[model samples]
Target chain A: MDPGTVGKLIAFCNNGQMQVPAPEPATDPRRHAADTWVVIPLYNEISVIARVVGELAAYFDHIVCIDDGSADGSAASAEAAGARVLRHPINLGQGAALQTGFEYVVGRNEADYIVTFDADGQHRVEDALEMLDLAKSQDLAIVFGSRFLDDRTDPGWLKRVMLKTVVWVTNLTTGLRLTDAHNGLRVIRADAARAIHLEQDRMAHATEIVLKLGRTKLPWREYPVELLYTDYSRAKGQSVLNSVNILVDLLVR
Target chain B: MNVMWIQLLLVVGVITVGLFLARPTGGDSHLALRRLFMAAFVIVAILSILFPQWLSWLANLIGVGRGADLLLYALVLAFLVFVATTYRRNVATNRKLTLLARQITLAQAATEDSASIHRPHEGTSNDDAAH
Candidate 1:
């Protein structure tokens, strides 16, 4: 979380102190935006999915929601909101849904980048667009959204500690030092996304993803993004004890 | 102090087997090893049943106070192994299920996309004919 560490990571990944220039207005940000697919793994968030999808629909033409067998009409809502919806016959957890989205997007030849967004309304669309732009402009294969890079997102004291611990574990296992371990917002170019085959069908997939993406050895950078942890998102947020399950899953498999 | 050796052996055996089974490998050799272990277990069961005195003699050699105690320890160890193997199998099964479900979802999506595309084309073709 330290600025010095982030600077070192940026230097190491870029192999020099490179500055990211602001996106030029003449280039038109939406020129290639159609090639970016926003993949949302929907579980039971019926109340906010439509709004989330609607917001994303404004920028990205290809927004796919993988509905993980929600009993509620979340898939219908997402579909009605002008986004493509893929439904699983049964609930297979978030990781499975994300993998389904990844496979589906990669199978299609249109998308150049896949943005994995959450359904809980925690992530910001603006941040997603910025990350996509950064990936495109910098020619980076992966850009992970890290809330800890800045003080904009306050995840509380305990949650902060737990997240830091998870990040430590993730970095140790993946050999990629990231400030955030489980943030759902990521921009993955199609080539790097193709290299990912996530077998972790649960929360552990967060760590598994970092490990697999690291193995690809593609250029990656962590971008500072604000996570709007509303009351709804906080209610649906992962409990600190779930980290134990993630650890066991990583160790046993 | 006499029973220390049995405790040590049990602990070491449990840890070793747990570590060994934790590795992710599944094929004909792994299946064969599982069957060999089952065969050894069945032989031990038969020998203990046929020659109950031999169980006590072996237990004494291993520093266990009684044959029953040794049997209980072995049963516990076997139960743990069963649990471990079952958990691993369940994980493997879940992975397969995930892949299957993903394939179904993707296939269904593809069909829907094609159908929608065809529907729009049908509408446009009708418009062209009217023009």
Candidate 2:
């Protein structure tokens, strides 16, 4: 929870996420009128949407939430949290929601960097600030937050094994020595992020982005961070077997 | 009655066409099964064509003249249906797998984005404070 530790985490992520510095003092900048924009792609996360948005809104200039056809009041909750809500007509999945957020950032002049956040309460807002700082400092095209760097805060045996396998396969296929290849936390330069078109409107879009980034040789960096797996997250989670399905999807797609 | 060669040719032609037409692409397991089905179809067709007299004799023994031809046709049709159904099921399963995979990928990206979104910055409320 230490902001300094968060900044060090960002630094670690920037430096190939190799050296994880101990938690430092939180010297990261506050929300500037011209700083980054936070984009939270939400579905049915009515319980925690407002808190997530309210927290991130304090540090970022704009908070845009793509309500991906949530049957619940996720959009209203996001709005209550002061997020500019964009609703999908139907459940177009998370990739489409994220693409909408990127589009919002690209169309606006106020955003220099774009941060993708989840609607679920799993991810903290402060991690976004660290990534923003790191992205700016390294002049990176894309900054991906990895959870595998700190061997201490690892997920259980099954997840660790599955993620390591995914990282291995992705590295083999894409030739990017990235650990935790499936971690979602990322900060992208507005132009660069927008330039990366996410064609797959489903989960495969994540793999697509990594592959495209490697193919394009965009200056990318991976940072290590902790994964907040709440009871709710554990309940709503997909099984590790889905990783094989993802691989097959990548093959067919 | 003596048109056994013609019948044999007919069976061979049908099998050749089936093999040429339904060229499915997938893993080896399915390829093996499809090959077996093709082989069975070819054998059945050849048996029915080459020995019409034998088929007629078998039918008479079973109290149904020329019934073996009907039986052969039924068997082939049933086998073909089964193979076709299996292929369709596999295709549907693969499609669903594709969709599920896509959803997982997006969820992961959203997760990464969420983490990056939460990192603490100076001057902001201590949101990163441990619960």
Candidate 3:
């Protein structure tokens, strides 16, 4: 695996995220990055964290990168890239990292919006910003970024079928019609986002989020986004069995 | 084909996994009970491997239909109990470990730049949305 690509993949590492970025001197409220906390769960993405976080910093101010016990200096790279870095003593799943980010924002009560972004290069910064705006303008509680919502990109046949199956299962269990069940980009309101506490410490958290939000009065929408599926990301993407495990986790736990 | 071979293969494969699990590591207290338990299984498994007909003979005396059937029933029951107990322990351990990791992350925040932790956002407007 390309170290940089793989580094982005495992960022499924989330710290008690949702850290408010230190504000810039002066900026437009519409474009303000501070009150919007972007949670980045990072594991061993030492190679690409700085670049990804740096690109994210262009739009949002407070970028919290959770380092889930990486042997490499992933946290350091994110910190250097103007993100607040939180450290986990051991490797927890990406779900735990996002939980940490959510809890941090809840604890501080300083953020207005919390955005969950993938550590993988698949996520586009432009898409995140647009989803953030849609969530705010439409007064929606959550804006889930869906690769299938629009035709900007294709995640390939096998991936499409896998994701569709996940979406189907998620909708069946949650009773919510979501175009994408496990895309890593999500923008949630502070209050509504706070209710999304994750117990599933692995990829199941994605489905778990759908279930949690579906039970609430939270209004949500799916925004179309693009995912750059390189040969690396395609190969490194989740195995089909992980979906079965996710289903079992959701049903049992 | 003789069913004995399948039973032998299954037991051998399972024992290989057991051997890996029983490999010694540093700082682990040696448990005599555990050693004894595994030793008993090893002996029984070897006995079954060596004397396949003995199980059927014993089973016949106990009114069981066949030796392989008796052995399979015993193995399945044992496996079920073992899985149930092991799963319970694994869940508990995972919960405790997750809590520890969560605490470690919550208690500390790292920034690339020194003196960046808790650096207040300047002239920040209202607390974004939620009060």
Strongest candidate by DockQ: 1
Relative to the unseen true structure, what is the C-alpha lDDT of residue A78 in candidate 3, on a scale of 0 to 100?
Answer: 85
- Interface RMSD list for the candidates: 1.0, 9.8, 8.6
Candidate 2 chain A — worst ten consecutive residues by lDDT sum? A20-29
Please, what are the lDDT tens digits per residue for candidate 2 over residues A1-253?
5677678667666675566544332564574336677777788988888888878766776888888778989889888878877766667667767876776567655678887777776676666676666677658878888877776464789888987887787877787888877766888876677677675566666777787777766687776666788888766555787787777656543
Better of 2 and 3 by TM-score: 3
Candidate 3 global lDDT: 0.74
TM-score ranking, best first:
1, 3, 2
* lDDT by residue for model 3 (A1-253), tens: 4565344324312211111111122234338487799999898777678888888888887888888888888888888889888888888898888898888777778899998987766799877776766566548798788877567778778778888988898999888888888999998889887787777898889988888987777887777788888775666678887778877766653
Lowest lDDT sum, 10 consecutive residues, model 1 chain A, at: A16-25
Better of 1 and 3 by lDDT: 1
The digit string of per-residue lDDT tens for model 1 on B1-84 reads: 768888898999799778866787676776798899999999999999999999999899989878998999998988988887
Which of candidates 1 and 2 is the stronger one according to lDDT? 1
User: How big is the positional error of residue A156 in model 3, measured in Å on the Cα after superposition?
Assistant: 0.8
Cα lDDT of all candidates, in order?
Answer: 0.86, 0.69, 0.74
Error of 1 at A41 (Å): 0.2
Candidate achieving the largest lDDT = 1
Which digits, one per residue and each the tens of the lDDT, describe model 3 over residues B1-131?
A: 35565556557756654553444321234345446667988998899899998888876765567988788767875685476446545665787788878876776642323234434542253465345
Please give, for residues A1-253, the per-residue lDDT of candidate 1 as tens digits: 4676566546645643222322333345465468999999998889999999988887788999999999989999999999899999999988899888888899887889999999988999878887777788669999898998768889999999999998999999899989999999999999998999888889999999999999999998888888998989998999999988988888887
DockQ for every model comes to 0.75, 0.04, 0.26
* Candidate 2 CAPRI assessment class: incorrect
